[model samples]
Target: MTLVGRTAAIGTLDEVLAECFAGVSRTVLIEGPAGCGKSVLVDTVVERAAAAGATVLCAVASPAEQDVPLGVIRQLVHGDPSLALPEDALAAPGVPSRVQDTQSFCAALREAGRAAPVVLCVDDVRFADDASLA
Candidate 1:
């Protein structure tokens, strides 16, 4: 693997991102320590996905505000105002507590993926809320 900077393993990430875009799994999770280049890998994957005509959604877990509900999902839908939530899904009982407002955003993501594969990157998992992690 070629190191892009002092930390990022660019070459390895590039290969993985390529496979991700090729519809290998549709979901790619890159986990590592704070300074271990996970964000760098996500960035590389986003770039490659864009180049391949895929939509990219990204969310970062913040250490200072890990309790925020649907923080990651909010970030993913912020720019795409047209995205809609599923009707009444949020009001359903026994729905996973961790995934709030799930109907709309989840449906929006599924719709986006139908048009073209979407690369959703969730970084800083260690700082993510336990509910969100579930």
Candidate 2:
């Protein structure tokens, strides 16, 4: 479906993608009130990135999952098996281990970008699990 009234947002995303392709890493946050098409906009951007041969990783936050530690992180890593944490770092079924710490998460994110320009699209940040957001 065609997305209406988001030409400027798409244009900016195009610029950001270009910069990332050029080895200049950056992050873009798309924020808006609930039911304002934020997810649709993000999906459009992800589509563009995919068409351009970018590695796209996505995670969506849900109210039900908000209390689950590292819930968002788990979702993000689930799409890419190479992102699996070492057994030593893996927490019990639903818990986030101390070894799966912020430092390690950031390190992994950087590593993914280095391997291939990655477009990490996270939606519904307000509902993201608090621990994961940290």
Candidate 3:
């Protein structure tokens, strides 16, 4: 897919995907105004990653779910039996144990990564649940 004005951004993400496939862990955050195509950019990458046989986990956050603890994390792995991960019980927001919750989430993703190259894409992240953001 050739995006009109996103060649550079797409190239960067493709390089990230390449690195990911090469066994390098990567984190990408795409932030912009409501109509700036952040989702489009990420969706494009997700498609590419999936096409390349990479494991693609995605979540789109919204205000309605912002108060749901670990909501975004749930979106990533919920109902995805391929991950074969046990459900996590994240402590509620403002709990000091959130640090550990983050590690737990990472552990789950790390387990999945062991199976294949993992590409996690979260969009509209401004409204992600607090604990999920940890």
Candidate 4:
């Protein structure tokens, strides 16, 4: 779908994407009432980033997944190619609440960032699992 009157928002996101590609850290939060096109805006930016060779990780959360541990993270990892995360990383359905597990996930993200610019997009984030949020 073509977005209307989002030139400024897209420009801002493009700048952030460039900064991230150049090894700088940036974050932007997009919020609005339901059906306001926040997700479409994000999807546009991330699709552009992916086309430019950035690693784009996205997850659209739902209330049904709120109780699942690391549900968002799991979705992100599973969507990545094999090399994005370690072969054994987050492979289990029921992830244990261990420090090592959390550390491993972090390590994997850091590793992926080192490989390429990483863009993480979480839509409907209010429904994201508490563990994933933490």
lDDT of 3 by residue, 1-134 (tens): 66799988888988988898889988888888779878788889889999988988889999998888777887887677654323345334333335665676687778888878988888888998887787
Comparing 1 and 3 on lDDT, the stronger one? 3
Instruction: Give the winner by TM-score: 1 or 3.
Output: 3
Error of 2 at 89 (Å): 5.0
The lDDT-based order of candidates, best leading, equals 2, 4, 3, 1
Model 3 CA lDDT for position 75: 82
Off by over 4 Å in 4: 79-96
Candidate achieving the largest lDDT: 2
Error of 4 at 97 (Å): 2.7
Score candidate 2 by TM-score against the native: 0.86
Q: In model 3, how many backbone clashes occur?
A: 0
Model 1 vs truth, CA RMSD:
4.7
**CA lDDT of every candidate:** 0.63, 0.80, 0.78, 0.79
Q: Single out the weakest 10-residue window by summed lDDT for candidate 1.
A: 89-98
Candidate 4 versus the native: TM-score? Answer: 0.86
Alpha carbon RMSD to native, model 4: 2.5
- Against the true structure, candidate 1 reaches a TM-score of 0.68
What lDDT score goes with residue 42 in model 2? 92
lDDT winner between 2 and 3, please give it. 2
Better candidate number, 1 or 2, judged by lDDT: 2
TM-score comparison, 2 vs 3, better candidate: 2
